[model samples]
Target: MKKKITVKLDIQKIVRITGNHGGYETGECLLCEASGWLEGEFGSPYSTKDTGADLVHKKNCLMNKVLA
Candidate 1:
């Protein structure tokens, strides 16, 4: 039997890397007031690729814990 490898999503790291790039209305890089946890111009910063969505969040937002 073959085992499947899973990669955990790093919210903090992604936030750090994409800092300020995503368009947030708060005028602050970290603070976002969009419907989702994080707001970006095209899609979620953590997105594997651009999808043209205005806002996006992971199934579970780990970054919120870090921010709070």
Candidate 2:
């Protein structure tokens, strides 16, 4: 039998990397005003790719959705 490997995203690490004073996530949030989340843009922060934190902005931030 072969084992499957799964890699889960760490919200705490994402929060720290963003220079925020908190670390936590609940369910699948698109944009959490209480948490100060900002959706995503269509351009590039460049460094975001290096740290792999873009997932929060693109997948959960919900900023873009709000703008629409």
Candidate 3:
């Protein structure tokens, strides 16, 4: 019998932005002030939906509703 090994990848969570440039009059994320709001709040531009402006990546907020 062969033993299988599983590897765990160590990766940090980095919020990603997917907003269109020149789309909004103001080029800034009101939710997280990350400069990108159109993008889904998750893993470069995290939004307040996850954490408030006071805390981002520093503290985890259960406000991000990925599907909703």
- Candidate that would win on lDDT: 1
Q: How many backbone clashes does candidate 2 have?
A: 1
lDDT of 2: 0.34
Off by over 4 Å in 2: 1-4, 17-56, 59-68
lDDT (tens digit, per residue) of candidate 2 on 1-51: 999986554443433223332542222232332222323422222234434
The residue pairs that clash in candidate 2, if any, are 39-63
TM-score of each: 0.25, 0.20, 0.18
Local accuracy of candidate 3 as per-residue lDDT tens digits, 1-68: 99998644222233334344575321332334343233333332234354332223322322233312
- Consecutive 10-residue window with the lowest summed lDDT within model 2: 38-47
Cα RMSD for candidates in order:
10.1, 12.0, 11.0
Stretches of candidate 3 off by over 4 Å are: 1-26, 40-63
Off by over 4 Å in 1: 17-68
Clashes of each: 0, 1, 7
Q: Regarding lDDT, does 1 or 3 come out ahead? A: 1
Which window of 10 residues has the lowest lDDT sum in candidate 3?
54-63
Root mean square deviation (Cα) for candidate 2: 12.0
